[model samples]
Target: MPSVHIRYDNLKPAVKQVLFGRLRLESTRWASFKSWYQFSAFYCAPGEAGAHEKGGVEHEGGRFRRKHLVPPPQVDSLAELNERLAAIDVAEDARHIHGRPTSIGFDFEAERDRLRPLPDDDYDCGIDLTPTVARNSRITVRQGYYSVPAKFIGQKVRVKLRANELWVFDGRQVVARHPRLTRRYTYHDFLDHYLEILLVKPGAFAGASALAQARAEGGFTKVHEAFWAAAKQKAGDREGTRMLIEVLLLHRQLPAEALVKAMETCLRIGSVSTDLVAIEARKAMEGTDDDDAELLTGDGPADDAGGESAGQEAAGARVISLHARRLPPDPRTTLPDMSKYDRLLNLGTARETSQNQKGQGA
Candidate 1:
């Protein structure tokens, strides 16, 4: 882009400051514009001096609305609407204008070849902010609340605000990203981010914004609901909700598809517990059924197996065996003679009687 022609009123304060070589304006895209593109800016005269300056831009806007916005689109999300508009733009590129020999797309292709390639690094088009996460692990940006991991509560984080997205950074690391909400006071919560806190406060999980969003978005599937209900029936509500939170936390370590499949298996078997859910999830992730047999039989690899050997054990290595061994009694045994034992007993008795008679005489 060689230059940009803009009306005085349309120029942002920062841009105006840069154009006029003034130091009053705060830092913003004006600095980026000078550093990144180095394009010449032409400002039209104020008011009636340049009434027709933006006539072409106005005409193009009207044409776009007439061509594509005559029938408004109904989309579930801003992303969907943007996708539709992008498709429309691409389609319109093929249109031929009056008196033009080539289509718009052809002309654009010819002109695009002359354009400069984008820089290696992307420009920061988002506003920077530092907001502290609240006790609920939620931060407010542009009046829209978004959840972060619970561990970040009470900690300040940097937030980058784009037109349709919010990127949160802890120092240089991006901790979370959310679709920017256009509605005031609306919240966007991610259930996975709050699972740790939910485990400690299971009652709140039932009414939390994160859980509500998960339910609305179909992330909380029927399997999840069934598992929760079964767990609640087996245990009380609090314990059951905690169990559900544990199952949900598995999503952090396991692929969500695998975890959901495990939950479905649990629901089918009428066995719902955190331990069972974790075991099922591990089985699903490992893509093996050997653990099922081990679990059923309450037997695992023998303790004598070395760690490395145990790890190398075949997936199908599950076998049971029973054996018994006896030792023979000692062979050097003989029966005693009853006659010699009786003679010794009679002699001892007679000696004791003689001793008693002598004592009486004395």
Candidate 2:
């Protein structure tokens, strides 16, 4: 018998009793992958090592790459490279292979209805790990530290590490989510995650990495800093920071824009009271649509509908207007006379109605 060759050099250990491919031995991991997709594996005949390469199967990929990707593309990120590759693939679908009457796309379109439907449930193509939270309320994932809620400190959390995001779960409940760090040993933090700990150790709030990250990320606005400065000045650092943390905790229940607006409201009156901020936060939220919150976000006036600046109109969404395809004025039908209503309302005749309608023949 010839030795088995696998694409993966690091195949995980398989089921002890289960075996396949004429004593080639399948790993459990490989078996599970195949079973999930309902895929069947066929290998070379016994004592025929070169049999699998009979169709030039392995060389097709190399040939395709050389043909399509001969000149390496310059891209800023993997996302950009993938986008470029997708465009290239779409372009190649129109290409006519040698001896084929129809283009690749035409053949594919003809057979598309015959292809098997994809699995209903999506496969999670992400790495999973369980990491214990450190004293700093952080977990090390692929040499990158990510902050979790302080309540989970010293406890193990399950993490799903995806291509661009990391999701931290305490049991089935998601506790934290952060963008995956591109650099090794780098860390990402959220200010809300550290609020509970900061409340107890008020002195730490000023120098906390989470606080710095929040400020840089626009989550901590100038309004928050202004409120904090006022609170500290009025009540001193220890007491003031504790109060700020209390207000920060409200973020779990309230929207960020509400908190920002509430902070601004309180700061206007020189108050650092957490109770007042809560009152204002609720007031800011009363009768408010979720989308309206974007306008009030404290960083600045954000772009509104049609990319217009927020300051264009405070009550813009309420302004109603009607528009439609312009039907040319029928020379036979006279325009409605609004002069009577306009005169009664004392707004003056609304642009003199067409006196020349009859003269402009139908």
Candidate 3:
């Protein structure tokens, strides 16, 4: 099977528009390719008369029939039909033609050289490179940085770079070229080229590589460490112990100010649970809705709603009292001392006499 890739460059836009309307287009047949390239498919039979001369079976024979030979059917719009046809042509060409020598199916392989060359780097493939400058004086491209000339600072400069290489251009002239870097913090040092920009926006780390380097060498961790140590010191022993957690939680979406307020409330109540902090933070903004209040305060609906409610509330308090009685007191704080005399006094006279007899017998 013979196939050919025809570049639509020679055809005028008007004529090309008509052909595209008649034929189907494959936009992503080579998706990596810019939109300038297009293709169509054809099939050939062994006995077909024009098999060798016309580059196998032209897949677009139906298009020729519908558009040129037969009564052209009315479409929603001529332009719309053309668009549909351009896409269809691409899809048809994207398929593997039958009776190929190789089983590994790739159209580029069979008719490799026949396809049109991609437009030259200079060619404006109608790509929207609408120029805009770097506000931060640095912009990240593929985990690397190519310094823009000093003049392009604080203004948009068009970046035209291809795979494995990048160019920072000031309008027409190429300002900088750097092999793209891939890791975080491994600075693509056009330092000589961009040191002035760097001096201005010291905190504005552009690429992943630069960010990683800053983390590794720029003391971000040390700053946090110093802050935490100072916090722990100020919190004084156990009170400041939760400050470490506060430090970490601050990194999340909840504002630090809200967290500090929540921590202060926690400290006031002598309770420092991270879970509690989150709950209180949410409560501050949106007052605890019915369910949350009920949960936190252990307030629930009375079984006898119509009856005297005070007794039920009292009962609930008593239940809480009983549970508290069963619970072990904190080891860190003072509690009632248990001694032999205390037990005897609590037991009363008859029990004391029995204890004395048992002690004597022992």
lDDT per residue as tens, model 3, 255-350: 545555555555544455557667666655564433434433556543344354557656763222123323477787675577988778777987
Could you give candidate 2's per-residue lDDT for residues 1-362 as a string of tens digits?
11223332222343333245434577655677656566555444433554453455447668778987788776644566678889988998998977899998999888787655656876665678999999998999999999989888889889999876899987788888888776789899898888877788999889998888888878888888888888889999899888888988999999988888888867754567999888878877884323233333333232335344334455453322222212355676667988887787654333233435545765
* Cα-based TM-score, every candidate: 0.72, 0.59, 0.25
Model 3: lDDT equals 0.48
Q: Model 1: clashing residue pairs? A: none
Q: In model 1, state the lDDT of residue 173.
A: 90
- Give Cα-based local distance difference scores for all models: 0.76, 0.72, 0.48
Worst 10 residues of 1 by lDDT: 318-327
- Minimal lDDT window, size 10, model 2: 318-327
Write the residue-wise lDDT of candidate 1 on 1-362 in tens digits.
43443233346644444334222343567666656865544555455755586566667778999878888877766888899989998898889988999999999888886666667777777889998999878998878898889899999889999877899987889889898887899889899888887788898988887877888989998888888999899889999888888888878788888888788777765678777778777877787644554544546545444564455555645333221112356575887669988999999999999999999999
Total clashes for model 3: 22
